[model samples]
Target: MPTSDVVVVMVPFVAQGHLNQLLHLSRLISTYNIPIHFISTTTHCRQARDRLHGWHAHDNFIKFHPLHDPDFTSPNPEPNTTTQFPTHLQPSFNSSLHLRHPVADIIRSLAKTSRRVVVVHDSIMSYVVQDVKFIQNAETYIFRALSVFYILCFNLIRLGKELPFTLEMKLRLPDATATVSQEFTEFLKLQYSHQTFHVGNIYDSSRVIEGKFLEYVEKDEIMGKRHWAVGPFNPVEISPDVSSSAQQDRHACLKWLDKQPEKSVIYVSFGTTTTFLECQIRELALGLEKSEQRFLWVLRDADKGDVFKKDTVRRLELPEGFECRIEGRGLVVREWAPQPEILGHFSVGGFMSHCGWNSCMEAMTGGVAIIAWPGHSDQPHNACLLVDVLGVGLLMREWACRDELVTSVMVETMVRKLMGAGEGVEIRKRATELGGELRRSLGEGGGGRKELDSLISYITR
Candidate 1:
């Protein structure tokens, strides 16, 4: 059979996290030899181009097209590259606001020669609602990069008086324990019954849940049959050189971690896009300091200059000498770090995270527990899944003051509890078991592998 001529256009907002997901999907599509067109702002395209400079050697199988979106440019002077991206700008969202025009143009261009055009798009750009009819003769499929569970929640919110009158709309309600309304929950069940495909979590299938949650998901056709979960799809190699200049000093964080005892180091990162007000950053620093445990932190543009001028920004402040006191005991990365490899490292015992899906999945694969501080959006939801449902993480409430930052005393206490203190050993054991299952699911003929095959078949045929 002739190869299906399809144009898979990914109009990703610029942030590294969004790019990672878009690129992973692109790579999978490319492997099937489907024509893929990836869209980004000029700045983002340049970033991707720089990373690919040495990697692909001019391979044209995947093409990058930059849209002329003004939002792509950062107005502030570039802050010195640091541990995480400055919060002032989120490039990943640049194209989303004005996505329809360019996307429709691309589809129209492709229609001149291609028989069918299937556009797999990120859910955030659901604004495609307006342009969906404009893209001539193309079948559009929405791609939700989040776990199936989260997608189900989103769909529930989108529902109208559907049956079982979901838990969100129910008369009788569960206590403070259940965040989602019973009416909404029932609506989700009804949606599942109606045969809509919800993505199944590949990592969860291999994990060992505390109260047979895995068994429940396995038997429920709504979750088991429809949704596809392929996660932590970081395209960067596990080991990228730590230095840009040959002579610049490179921190030997992994080497130091090698000497530490197993499960001793806590990895702390707020992801590439979250920017805390200066006070919060300082409190976090002080909390880590008080914790006294060996730690690895990524501190990007901490002074808040990345978001706006420090003087102009009212809430910004980093604790004085916070790094000096914790210097040797911690390895602080200023820019980007190879996260997946670091998470998989033996020295990483636990994670202090912002609860992003990619980080959550990586932690799950590493079998490391988490101390979650959800900054925004779906992070809070992800945190709930980790702490309440999975039993693999501790929920850290939002703290504005130093006293509440889970000081060294609290850190030590929590670590002790998670390590084997209060039913800690069992949680650790379950996490390890889940990690093993995730590895297998990504391996030959595993659930993840099979799902990718099915997704490809759906798109290609």
Candidate 2:
């Protein structure tokens, strides 16, 4: 067992992807018997706990410290906006800054009892832990909740390093025009500046897929801060009881998957933050109907300004009779669905996704082939990795075409190409092979395991 004298504190950004990554990492660290205090807003802490699985038995080792931000406002959805990014989330992002003082206080209190207080904060959440440097026994590490490929490319571009890759293919750095608000832009700048204080970096990536990119991160003078690639932070195996009774009851889609043929269903989801216009939703529905493939689709509105607010009776609607037309062949879930469980299902062969990093890691680790429909931010880079570098996915549409309404015919063609037997057969084979490698990396002798062990030793020693 690792030393109990060392306590780790986790601070994550409020986004679902960022929170989930840190929560999983906390679970992994708890296995070493290191106490972890996870700091977040009360709502976000609830969000993490609700979604947490595979580590229920280790709950004692992890303590959730919910900070109340009285001034924070919930996001109100703007239905007519053409922006592909989740600009509605700006309020929540801004509210997260209010956590700085309370988070610092928690760190100071933990530092009093522990010989070492190692803080693992999200890359975007550096402001919350900036005061840790003054706490003599405390040190911070920036935990990148993104692919190494995206991080290294973003860092290289920031340093004006000429690369073989084009700007469109890389993860773009935040700029004044890039964000919806000036406050958000300044918050992003603060996040970038605080990185210099971190003692090291930790990435939710694996050497199996990003070996070369990991090397690039290590050699970069500005970013080479003793990093560790201990990821696919999510569990490798799907737990039978991943969700609570209520969630399982809501997820009838899983029960539906069990009845399908092996490698036949195409799991379709755009993640929590993506919201589509009625026209786009209609086009997507038409394409799925025309493709004549078995599919499970998670349909939900883009997050509201306030995530915890009661759902409005107004919900995004599909074309009339769309569900009836594809009755047995398609399942459209309006509530939250267990993505990792669905992707890990034997019946799920391909994923039609928005190519979020968390979704990419889940799909890659599950060995499910991807139909990439990238939206904005790091998604385009993640799509590039999945479709170009990994050769385990096919691109449906690019971010450049996001404003243009993708016709039903175009969607039908991409769906057919990914689910059909021609090129998809090769893609599936590669995905399966890659999934095996990723899962192995989480096992005894794998690179992820080695790096995780190294991280524990580095902190506990």
Candidate 3:
């Protein structure tokens, strides 16, 4: 196995967070002169190709292997764009999950070439890896883009380490708030079913699983296989080189930040997968509006209501004219926000985040205080680590569980406390220290660097 020419094929879950992390990992590996081919369905492939258009790699060095499931017809297809999260509720999104044969065909073609074919997939898509291996001489690996705690806790349950606690009881953790319902559902789903994406659990473990724990599984083959914890992939490193659309958005955001006081603004955003019921959104909207603090809110579905209308994909109705109401004090980012850039800014004092591991890495690395609002899945646990274990930030309880409804008053109080001086000083300081530590870990001779090197070595071994 030679390092120079071996072809590593990376496939990601349909969601952009997973797709973006694997893409960044490919960029890191592109320097080895390895031909990296990314595979996904048509929509995901298009976005991947677009992002790599001006990539630093050599010409023809990187490519995409996109497949269409011939048997699965998309129902709400063309109207839904890549920017929005595709809920399985949409009849059009069925193709996102049914990729076994389409991806298998990609491996078959790559296997014909003299170079070895290794398929690295997101855990949500791990089911397809088995099918890829059945193709001639192909290999399979798993790359998880989730936080280590999320991985460790979930797997400990599967391994029965949390025995006798009973599934109904909260899975006790070193972090203060032990995960109960959300985590249990994750263990049950991943242990039993592969289709983790569910409408009710919106952003639940059903959509993603803890692949990091797979390394600990007692299988000889799994032990021998290549696995990498190659993430909280830094967006700051990749922000300087962004797609044209991304650059435009980045420019607008940075320009706004330039005028603000240092560390005075709290940046708010939920990753693509978290969808809010109207009441929840109203609470968040009013909360931010009434908080009377300088902020930026990237609302994924600002204009949405109880129904999905074909015409409303681009325009969402917030607490009508909410942007105007907050005018100078806040900015509501409706389109895709450049999160890494915002977090890395000096003026960004705090982050009101979804507690997605990726956002945690960015905010912590930037040394920004957190207003942890974990709506679903591992977020509540991620929030616990930030607030209780790490002592980095405070939790926004209004939006904790998926069904939890936060009020404007609650949101306002958190905003003032997080953005104002005094008690928040210690939390901010802790977040800064943690951010520095994480950045160092990903930097020269850092743990992330060593793991990445080992991954490269495994592929070329």
Candidate 4:
């Protein structure tokens, strides 16, 4: 089949982290002139297109297909990237359970064109897509947006292999309490609760990234399935002109960064999906206030939408007198701040992050040290790799496995250790060096590009 006739259909979870990684993967694959059909919720499709600055020119080579919610009959049917999306209606968009039919239709249509179609969907969709073996000239691949470390651990859990219980011990078992949500609880349970590999079912293949730039662990002998390491799919450079409704926050963040000393500020965020209890939120606020370091904090309110209208933002309350205490040294923004844009800033020295794989990859690309504060999912494992294996991150000690309400003192100590002069110096140096290595490994003849090319060849051959 001709390269032009080879189409890759990519489906990402509705959340930002999954969508961002898969969107970049779409970019990498489309560079070879092969067409891509990226499936996402209508709101998320517009979100992707808006953030994807250069791809406006790739109209013919790429397409963003929207997945609709048939049950949304209350009259507000527009797309939403942030809190504009009603809380009750969000599950319909986030899960593959609802997307199964639409995705199947996409596969069937592509098969009819006689084009070689490869369906690359988020790992959560495994059970639903596993049975989609009837399409002609179509292959399904599971795109694990997490790291090899996380994937290996998950596979072990599924096989009931004994695992060392360390940090994130809550997720070590199925019945452990969750800080995330009921929806995430289901996603967390799906992998271990079922036997994932079924002959002629499940997936034809799975893909992962080289975590902390380490060697890939051989898994075929254990799982009886092939896994491809094709990433560090995080883009080396992010365009600053990407459009978003939160333009004011972006401008304020950049303008504020301009006034700070180089490498003197830490960027703190827990991502869009990670849930935080009221006390955890209070502890973080008090900790940053006590750290005495210049910082930018992304704080979102748990009870309401991110925005009330234009010019107003909603977020949980901070410690009383919090702003005045850190007057010259802190700036807080509600809702999603432009993470890539912030991380790329030279004045930004380190990140206090949830250690989500996408956030890890982005921080590495920008060459910043991380203070791994994992909250949920495979994040704790990713944090383990960052701090223990890669030597680029420091653990908060208090944020390990559960909703442990870390006190202000604990938060202050970790923040100070991360940003102040001392052991963090070596970690910062290593992080910078590793960042360079990751960037080089994805450039022109880099391993990631080569692996992607090989994947395309295999699917079409």
Candidate 5:
């Protein structure tokens, strides 16, 4: 059990990837008998609960605080737009600033009852908790939802240090500046400036795969801050029985995987924020059909500018007769699919991903190789880590040429190469080996476990 005088509050960015990371961390922290308050918009708070996996025994230790954003409006996406990034989410990001006052009020109220209120907030959400420094009984820490490799590279670039690898300077940097609207850019600026005060840093990363990068982040004079890499934050175990019936229903793909051969299926998902053009979607569908490989694809609409409103008219339609032709060879899940469960299954051999840090961590934990097709932001950097640094995946497309449409032929070729016998065999072996190391790191007395313990102790003290 932890000290009664201490309580921890979590503030995560509203995106699915960001929200999920902090929620997982909250669950881990709750295991130490520490109470956690997870705060976010009402929609996101509901998302966190609905998507939560594994055991529910620790639910009492964690609480959800949902704040309403009245000015927010979900805008319909322009499916024909040339931009590759999820620019449609700008409204949602801008509206999050409205939460500052309410979030601060909640923190102030909590501080009155607790001797120490430790605020762990997303790096992009620092502005929401800007008032923490003035609260006599409270302190704040920054939680980086990205991988250590990407974080190290970003800091190096910010400090004007030469990059470790040869790549376009623009591709390595955070692409939000180039892709987002001016209003969103200003919002980012506010967040950057407000992060001036924080007690320490926390990362959703681990020493096993990113040891050198983690060291660089900790040693660099300008970037160095007391930090912990207690990650692969998602549960490492595969516990099907722990899921509720509704969750089980959502994960019907697992039943299909059970019937497939060992390491024979590839799981494909671009995450919640990636928007695809109809033509591109068609090409991808045709490509999967041509690859002739067993696959499980999660086909969901991109997030709207205002997430609360549904854009029923502008749906992403698959190529006509595509599903019919690939009937037994593929499974298309139109709703939310249990990602961790799918990745951990025995039949899942690889993942075709956007290389978002959360997806990267889950893939690593599952020991699955990647077929990297990064869109924007830190995704390209993450793809580089998986393909070049880790040697456990293959890059299907580079970010420099992301503007061009990837044809059905190219997708087919790359998919076949990753699922077939030569280079794919080597990558899969390395992925499996690395996955073992990552899982072990979360075990008793391991590096991740120790770092988490140290973090818990620091907060309580």
Candidate 6:
């Protein structure tokens, strides 16, 4: 007997989005009856386990292994000192730099006991693709975890000449041609001529397998054909609880929304991690008030951290029933909301968002236009895609403000545009078309679905 069988190992970077992708992938892998060992820092591993609480038998086949800090074990690094766990240990920590060594070591150990071990990884940890011996599985599949459109944008930049400024500078510039290399300008030319946008190419295999948006555009060959993009996957079913937190919030919003007329509410949420200064929060509240539009706001208690204690969820000082003032008009509140279900709600007309990819996807898929309020990281890039490339969203100014945040005027303008009040109808039409295309990508026999099935076959075989 070979005494070796396939073991799938995943070490997702510690972040909500990254973890969500890995967990979704893990669920897909589990359906194949393959053994899986998902490795993570002690805290993260605990959290992942908690998400699936009571759902599975705690066993070897589907195991959650915690990597604890060596210092915390027994012999302290020194009598009074302790070794620091790698920064990747917590979801709130920056994970890019610290995960490589620990992950390489874990995969190496797994290889010793399994004859056919495979490493499934996220794009954020793309460095693993270069370490062959560390992951000596019969197969190693690099899971690309970005949308094909985003990947295309990245690849086009890579394929062309270096631009004078950074990619960010180029995207942020109001005029597209001002900051980029001429070669890129020409490439984008060919792209738009063909009804495509030249999204540069930097891919994650996990994304192609997990990204639910690849089925929209026509697929073409690029990078001379890489082993990547076997995915851009979409599982036919998402467990009701898979996104329960977001859903729970969504239900609450619906209660307020049910009282309003169709397409009357503008939804605002900055996502789980992003926080704004008190000044900015107040501006948003006032902006909602000024817009005179009915709204459902999900405000986090920690928006005023340091000023408030951790247990102080109740001391949320608002603009004095600004809730009462906006009464019958707007609802200002806190707690997690079911974002996707809310975006898809009939009452939601526009979204004031932080432009996270998942949020962008859900909003667009639901035919809701966005007021892009990008905070950091890939959000700015995604905002560019939404505003410049897709034309379905409006861009909020970069500066933070409470009075000026989403001022009543801006809110009303966005509402008119998003709700198709006048010339805005065109934007709505474009958004609706994109939603249809996004749906087609996930529909039965669609590219995303087919790709997902192909990924499952690859993992099981």
Model 2 global lDDT (CA atoms, 0 to 1): 0.83
**Candidate 5 local Cα displacement, residue 267, angstroms:** 0.9
What's the C-alpha lDDT at position 455 in model 2? 91
User: Per-residue lDDT of 1-461 in model 2, one digit per residue for the tens?
Assistant: 23348999999999888888899899889999888899998888888778765445347999999888546556555657756677778878877778889999999888888889999999889877889999999999989887887776666666777554567544332321342345566777888887777878898889999988887767765564598889988888975753577446645888899889999999999987787778989999999999999999999876654566865624878999999999999999987788988999999999999888999999999999999987767777788889888999998865556678888999899889988989989999999999999999889987889999999999888
Single out the weakest 10-residue window by summed lDDT for candidate 3: 198-207
Alpha-carbon deviation at 96 in model 3, angstroms:
3.8
- Candidate 6 structure quality by residue, lDDT tens digits, 220-259: 4543233334222223223344466755643556677778
lDDT of each: 0.57, 0.83, 0.62, 0.66, 0.83, 0.55
Candidate 4 ranges with C-alpha deviation above 4 Å: 1-4, 50-59, 72-90, 93-95, 127-131, 163-219, 222-225, 239-250, 302-314, 398-401
Mind giving the per-residue lDDT tens digits that candidate 4 earns over 1-461?
22347788887765566777778788777877778898866766766655543234255767878877334312222222221213432444444466777788877877777567777777766655554576757777767667766666666655666554555543433322233346555665664333354221111112222433223344344443444565666557766554565455456778888799999999998775555656777888888888888999988632211112233323477778888888779999874566777888889999998887778877887789999877555677778777866788898864433444678898799878878889988888988887777677666787655666677677667
Candidate 1 whole-model C-alpha lDDT, 0 to 1: 0.57
Query: Where does the lowest 10-residue lDDT sum fall in candidate 5?
Result: 168-177
**CA RMSD (A), model 2:** 3.0
Give TM-scores for every candidate, taking all chains together and pairing residue i with residue i. 0.72, 0.93, 0.77, 0.80, 0.93, 0.68
- After superposition on all CA atoms, what RMSD does each candidate show versus the true structure? 7.7, 3.0, 7.2, 6.0, 2.7, 9.9
